[model samples]
Target: MATDPDNPPAEVLAALAAMGFKNTYSGGYTHKDRGKVLDLHFQKDGTDLFQGWKAEEMEANMAAITALFSGIGITITPRVMTLAEAYA
Candidate 1:
């Protein structure tokens, strides 16, 4: 069977939920920082899995996510986006 990279495995999602991350639509999830929303998207590159998000918010939640998933061996990749790209 084929699996979608954007949508992580059930175990991963469950693990993340257990760690207090809120599951958003589809493969998206978010962690709140102060009044800001740290958006996350699970993506796949070949057989490797990684999380993608806007660079502006990377510092806000990258460490937390890395720590949370380090034991599980997941990679987090930041996506650079311009203001127009981000807002679009």
Candidate 2:
């Protein structure tokens, strides 16, 4: 499997777009005395993921990404953030 060990979340999201995945949302979660945790949400169809040519299999592939990242020392947390504070 091809892997990008040094890829950042924004890059991953861009890659998803390049691969035809649609962007659904972008937001962050607040942390006390720290900063907000950010994420970019994407969604796509999931019928030809293994083939990797169609864009209609993104959701399934994204789920697989979540699982893969989870196993590879990454954590997924769903939370809310204020855009005003985030930009500042």
Candidate 3:
């Protein structure tokens, strides 16, 4: 695991991209706040996810990511940013 949040593990980034999560604010940045690891926003627009990703796909994708994270012993959890918190 990379110590830099802007550049997390390659596999983590890949999985996030594959899951339609946009790197709105890397380095765990979010709406004037900073946490750890990364801040991946799923929907740039209100309730609008990436094309072809769809709402239903999130479950499976998340499952895969969870598995991958578990394999790597990553216990970092993510949160959903409000529309006002996300990028405009």
Candidate 4:
């Protein structure tokens, strides 16, 4: 099951909320606003980036997330974006 890193399903977000993960981001599928920060492409725009939730958010709900994802046979492991290249 390949899931989109940019947009997790609403159902999943809903479940996450039921399990105690709350956020004020765009549809709960994005990180908090990175105002005035350059993106990976060096663009000084798009403060509200979208690429699923932030790492810290996941870290805070790892146990619940892992358990939920595992139920669907999806094993998720969190790692640094730069360091994740090694695993690839």
Candidate 5:
């Protein structure tokens, strides 16, 4: 419940960074032209949530997130939303 809101946990940020996501000043991370794939706003309490633009992207990122966080006993939830939902 106590989180930065403007930034993910350092470990999560580092992991995502290692996987090619770049943090932005607006409290989210993006990759290439993929837009914002991860954000603190998507997080729910103890869970780390990821929202990808497409199935392929979500699948790929899910695997990487699982691989990275599962080792440390953290749970990552990956989701896909339409562009409208993503913006709304």
Candidate 6:
């Protein structure tokens, strides 16, 4: 999720909480002038959920996506790696 910790929307927080996720740590992103963070959560059944939000605010279109996946108990686990980090 591309979001600032200070002002995450209510819906975002609630959905994350319901999925049993907890924010572990985050890092600063100089290029984007935004704080890039990694949030981790685990399900007892060992499911994975990964999604991203890049817009200024939660756009109406994207909101439906999470809801649809979340309702079905689907977690989209993405393979996250930076180009530099991966090549290193």
lDDT of 5 by residue, 7-68 (tens): 54778666667777664434444557755444443221222344434656656766877888
lDDT of 5: 0.57
Candidate 4's C-alpha runs over 4 A off are 1-8, 27-60, 80-88
Q: Pick the winner on lDDT between candidates 1 and 5.
A: 5
- Candidate 6 regions off by >4 Å? 33-65, 68-88
Q: CA lDDT, every prediction?
A: 0.51, 0.56, 0.58, 0.52, 0.57, 0.50
Q: What tens digits encode model 3's per-residue C-alpha lDDT throughout 1-88?
A: 3245655567767876776666664344334335455544443222344444456565666676688788878764758889988766
Sort all candidates by lDDT, best to worst: 3, 5, 2, 4, 1, 6
Task: Tell me the alpha-carbon RMSD of every candidate.
Answer: 14.2, 10.5, 6.5, 13.3, 11.9, 11.0
Q: lDDT tens digits, residues 1-88, model 6?
A: 4445456455765666565555555454433545554443332222223454334323443354466567767675545699998799
- Tens-digit per-residue lDDT, 9-68, candidate 1: 677576666655664544322324333233344432222235443454455456766776
Instruction: TM-score each candidate.
Output: 0.40, 0.38, 0.43, 0.37, 0.43, 0.34
Q: Output the TM-score of candidate 4.
A: 0.37
RMSD of 4: 13.3
In candidate 1 the C-alpha lDDT for residue 21 amounts to 60
Candidate 2: where is the Cα deviation over 4 Å? Answer: 1-8, 46-88
Q: Whole-model lDDT for model 2 versus the true structure?
A: 0.56
Residue lDDT tens for model 2, 1-88: 1233234455555556766668677566555655555555565554565544354454556566676567658766644569987698
**Stretches > 4 Å off in candidate 3:** 1-52
In model 5, which regions exceed 4 Å deviation? 1-8, 26-58
- Please report how far candidate 5 places residue 73 from its true position, in Å: 2.9
- For candidate 5, the per-residue lDDT at 72 reads 74
List clash counts for every candidate, in order. 0, 6, 0, 0, 0, 1
User: Ten residues in a row with the worst lDDT in model 1?
Assistant: 40-49
For model 3, which pairs clash?
Answer: none
- Cα deviation at 73, candidate 3, in Å, is 0.9
